[model samples]
Target chain A: MKLIDRARMKSPWVLHYNSGSCNGCDIEIFACMTPMYDLERFGIVNVGNPKHADVLLVTGPVTYRGARVLRNLYEQMPSPKAVVAVGTCACSGGVFRNCYNCIGGVDKVIPVDVYVPGCAAKPEAIIEGVLMAVERMSEHTPLKRGK
Target chain B: MAVKTILPFGPQHPVLPEPIQLRITLEDENIGQVLPALGYVHRGIEKAGENNDYPLNVFLVERICGICSATHGLAYCLAVERLLGIEPPPRANYLRVVWAELHRLHSHLLWWGLLADAFGFESLFMQIWRVREMVMDVLEKTAGNRVIISVNAIGGVRRDLSEEQISEMLHTLEECEKQLYALLPVMLNDYTVKKRTAGKGVLTSEQALRLGVVGPTLRASGVAQDLRMTGYAAYGELGFEPIVEQGGDCYARAVVRARECFQTIELVRRALQQLPDGDILTKPRGNPNGKAIVRVEAPRGELMYFVVGNGTKNLERMRVRTPTLANVPALLEMLPGAEFADIPVITLSIDPCISCTER
Candidate 1:
């Protein structure tokens, strides 16, 4: 109960990275920012630099060429950061999953914390994903020095 | 020896909506050169032409690009119809004009939203989408698809606009126009937006013509070269001139779009005013040896489709010369001399659709 409470209270900052997507997911992410949804009210600001972020919001199916870039970006974020795969494309490669150019979902490369599923997932669904990530974060204890 | 660094600008860039990769050669943030790589989402529609009959190709071609799908089918059909030597019925022509103009309105609205997005003007982006939603509702209620309106067939349109629908659309246009009029001051006269866009990415008339730049980009450079001047569709019956600007910069290009939005509204109202009554389509008489090069004024600029039929079920060649591809060299030309900070705004001013270009 204390862990969950701590997770909720910390209120991680987000960094959205588009690996390779149609703007559908990106626009919906911004839609989450507007007055109706207002994720900012929870201290979830989309910071420009990944180093400052605690939650990595990834959109689009990571394409063959973009896989390396995504890995580098994921590594850049500070420790204890959670990766939330937004949209079906990022989670399961959606429509472009099996295409010659696509490298499948982000899970193929990184450990995703929560999956937000939608063709271009609605803003409400995105917020729910964030909440889920927060809940998941509460369950984990930091790794020991050698472990 | 120091190896040169190649930066991949997209497949996912902050500014562009569609996925396109620019393999950029950079000498410390100043781009030395740009090489575009495309076909990330090629669905092999051109090859699909062999399987689908000529009649069904209309619906098939419309799926090429979500935003300009209608225009794609329209350009293709106009080519094929011209080969058969048949003019559409008057009612069909007027309806085509009305729908085409409406598409121009929605497309420009969409572009406006995207431009705002690229420049980080979030509030304006939302407002543009809000207005665009109203336009989409009109399209959905009329043609039944929010994005791809499969209304244009070979001979004419598939359906007719009822008097009530026409009146409703006109009323909607008035409301949209009022909203747009309200937005004009904010977009054009605003201090920050103008500062970001004005006098940036200047393409002179000489440069525009030399680069074969068409549509609004050309008009923005002070050239009066609209394909509509050729009067292919119902544009001749419903009279309007191309909107041209003299600035030849990003501001001029935006002004061209803004003026054309008003022109499109006026064009739709005119089409509604004198819409004649007749059958919508005629049966396409198959012609195997027909060939045509059709040009139309897309929201971007001049779009040219060259199609040749080999007296068979499929086309010999279906080549498209998109406006963005033409403007790319111009974009590169403007990019080299300008400061690095202006890249996003300059790119946005051209209003590129990489899918259309790549396809």
Candidate 2:
């Protein structure tokens, strides 16, 4: 009911991270920003800095070296944040399950709120994942600042 | 004088969405030395290829770089097919060309869009990607998926084009060609884009040749080398010619790709028009028992695949060489002595795909 919560529901800036993808899911995420899919219609904008973002859209199976960076990005975000794991690799390590470098799935490094499953998750499915993250954000109380 | 500083770019930079970190040392706003850090997106797909069955590796290699995935799939399939001593049907080879060229069309469009965004030309970025969706739609309609179509199989193609699909695809290409013509001129000749890209990352023909820069990077430097000219798959019959640019700068590289988009559309249209009538697939009988190597022209440049099989379903070894790997050293050579702010433009000029590199 507060002003911040109302604004949060109206718009959610999302951060996308490619821990160890083949770039399939990453390009689809990029497509969501383009004219055709246009995630802007839903008020979902892709941000670079983790601190200013509300929803973290993580793609790819977490690789050994990328794990540390992945953890760092997730921790930098403010409270009441949601992580959406995009693609089959990020969800459950689609084909790279046996690769020694990949620990497999975004959840291995961080808790995932929603999993959009595809080899390369389509823009439509990725939009659905962001919407799902927004819905979950409405359920939580916006964290009090300057605690 | 600006103070000397060490700046690490990416693994999470706004301009570069993919994972690649550039360690640039700056002296008074001019870059002194540059180093690239990798291993962020390494999935060890080469080893996975050795473990995965020969047929299944088609899908595995497709994941190497989603932008140019079909070329990866085609090269892998071609290598294994050679080892097995079976040729794909004639019609299948033509279909392979169709899909590969379509992938190139979309991949270059994506690169142009990203390059425009890198220099903060937001509307051009949006406009380029919008035209790109027409190619994506045709890919999805024919190959049954957008980015990684997976239409290619070991012996031949897994999908077939019906009468309606062929007609629809041609209509889409006509519209796409029209839209691409309207937008690409802005990227090629506009003063603002020229200021940002022209002469920004000039790699002389000698430097590009010595560095073994492949694809548009090489063509931009006025070298006439394209793997497609070597005539693998249906390219021999298609009579393909490489697009060449003499500038060897970021603008020249962009021009090569811009022209390549039109060439790709023509190749696809010709292949579809000359569509041979027959089965799209043929099954190989015996397991692969020798070593074979195949090189194909990916959207970025040359994509090579080496496979060794010992009369078994599992490959003894599978090695891949992506074009980005060939272009990086040349990129390192281009970085020093350039303005620090031009880093993103110069870095993207090579169209670096670290995932393909580390794999």
Candidate 3:
């Protein structure tokens, strides 16, 4: 029972959500799964369900319409989940910060544990962010959403 | 009497990654109506374009669609250059074609892999993406970043290709093309692939013209109207022709893209062979002033950029009409009669880029 958190990190299923990204970070995140990057070798599977996810990878500046969906996705994930804001936009709204529809970064909608910063956040950075998220997620008490 | 069920297919879905909800009304397992609800990724980039300095807008527009950012950057540069009345040097023109073709090759490969994934062809998907990685490597080797290389500058490309880089790129392209051919039997001739894509979501040439569809979608429907024919950049000198397939169905669209991959490879080879030896940049004296409308062939279709400058750093108005936006109507037309099971496959067939559409 004590090792459950550690066990969870061993094989974490990731859920990727694109709130309002330009598809830059999202593609890099997807590229992580390809043969060259081979993220699956680490036992990280990109899942579609929020319930099955141990970590959430979000890309883009949260737009007004996407903010609700972002919050909804975060709230639905089981406790002890970690959110990694991938890309400059998700970390701090990047270039889309001043755009009319943008509501700023992912932190505005959900508690982000790690920030993977890049215009398109390279696949290496995204993989590191997910791993960092795994460590951070394990540190959570399993009772609360964020510490 | 058949009862209709309304189902929302993403702002978040497994098959199509980016968020664009489709309100699908199903009647007895067949899709009745699919109204695409697309406000999720709308960051108001057109408005943002007007706010940014003309030089900076190149980067901003590139972010509009990461998959084809290089093409987007090229189009924006072409537009602004026209406004400034200064042409990029000859070497810059040839280099632009090389990178743009590489961009198209990768984008089509990505779409090809995604289509395979959409139809549950897992191993095929992985194989195609593996080949795509070679293109990414070339882009990184010559330019720097993988996806958004930002090689494009105001008057010319930022990076120049070395002879070593050119030979290495050609070697990679040769290997990639061979791998693509090995996969072609399964992608085209395989019964399963055909079952999923053949005669599905067909848009006849007339309907295609009426819908104002662009890119492979139009080419699939037998319309040979690629903006590249108008010969922007180095396409004129390269003697390019649109890859047209007459099937006009989902399979045709897939075939158009598949055939286009080979054409793009040849284009890159030709452009590299004819690469002019000269300075790449021709420095612009002052801020751009006047109106310029430029359209270039993006991976998806025709990407149009209209910039109106007032002799200032910031443009008075910058309007971008992305290929995906033009193709959405064609997608809407194709969805009404498709089975629920085929929705994902049909959607993938168009290679829809919701980010580009909404941006």
Candidate 4:
């Protein structure tokens, strides 16, 4: 119902973190930003800093070390935030579930709003996932300050 | 008097697609020393390979790095095949060449676009990646997926290219070549690209050899060694020479990759013409029992797989030495004397794939 919220829905700045993926999903995510898929046409920009991001796009199964970092990134983002897990690895650990150092998927560390499942999670799926996250952001209430 | 400051470059940075930390100690804008801290992206795939069956490990290895997934699978399968004392059929070998070279083209194009981005030439970056989509399209048409094709099996390729598909691929490649040729001058002779890259991050031939750098990094420094010369997976049948440059700078490395892209296109055409009629797989018999070392020329450089099988479903050990790991030392050598601004360009020159290194 707010004016800023309406504009935020139109342009969602996404922060990408590779929690320990094989780079398949990460590159596909990049492909989505390039001229071919041009996810930018929807006003989604891949930002490097967590503070400026509205959506957190995570790829790869969360490795032991990546879990803490992933949580920190989630905490850093301002609320009305949504997390989209982009690949089978990030969704449910995929083939790396049994790996000794893996902590399963991103959800193991943080709540996931949307799950995009594919071996590498094609660019189209990633675009759809981000759109879903933006929609989720619109419906959900932001956490109250000093709760 | 020089002021010293420490700059931490990544684990997450805009310039890097993967996570790897470089601690650069700067003395008044000149890098004094560099220390690299890794394992941020390590998923323990090597240890995981010990639990999976040999056939299943093929898929596991393919996930190590998406850009060079085919070569990773090829190296693992080659090692396993050697252990089992069997070879993939000739048709499979030729098909492997086709797919591997396609991987090379796509990987190089991806790297080229990234390198352009590193130097702040955004339009050039877009142009290179746009042409790269044709290669990805051909890959998707021939194989099911875009990245991580998963075409390689234990004994041979999981998929086969039909006559019509081969012709379509050739047509796509020709179109790709035309686009690439038009853009080649911009990458090779453009003012901005040249100024940023030329004479920056110079690695001498002796330094390259002493550092044991592999692939385009070493080739750019004037060493003409490419693992494809070893005749693995139909490279011998389709003969070609390594593309070498003497500058040993970022520009030289870019030129080597750009030239190799064209070379790989030609290789794909030749392999298709010489493709034989036969089975794609040989149905590898018996469990692997013994150690075998296999090497292949990946898009980055030489990729090595060391496998130890114990006549059981699971392998005893699987150690992968990726090209990025070898090139890291070369990166360390190139960094100290360089300016802070050129760090990303030099780093991207080696095409650092931390996932592949840490895996």
Query: B41-118 in candidate 2: lDDT tens per residue?
Result: 998899999888899999999998888889999999899989998899999999999999999999999999999999
Across B1-359, the per-residue lDDT of candidate 1 in tens digits comes to 43456777765455665556777776665666777776554434455554566666776566445566778878988988877778888888888888887888988887777777777888887787777777777987999755567789888998789889989999999999999999999889888789888988889999988998877888999999888888887888777798989999998888889888899999999988998887999878766466899998888888888877878767777777878888888887777656557778888788886656754
- Model 2 clash pairs are none
Question: Candidate 3 residues B169-218, lDDT tens each?
Answer: 99999999999999999889988899999999989999999999999999
Q: Which scores better on lDDT, 2 or 4?
A: 4
What's the C-alpha lDDT at position B202 in model 1?
89
DockQ (0 to 1) for model 4: 0.82
- Which regions of candidate 1 are displaced past 4 Å? A1-147, B1-7, B25-31
Q: Candidate 4, residues B223-265: lDDT per residue as tens digits? A: 9999999899999989878899999999999999999999999
> Candidate 4, fnat value?
0.83
Candidate 2 lDDT at B330 equals: 91
lDDT of 2 at B274: 89
lDDT for A41 in candidate 4 is 96
lDDT of 4 at B359: 90
Q: Which structure is stronger by DockQ: 2 or 4?
A: 2
Fraction of real interface contacts that model 1 preserves: 0.02
Q: Best candidate per lDDT, number?
A: 4
Reference interface contacts recovered per candidate = 0.02, 0.87, 0.90, 0.83
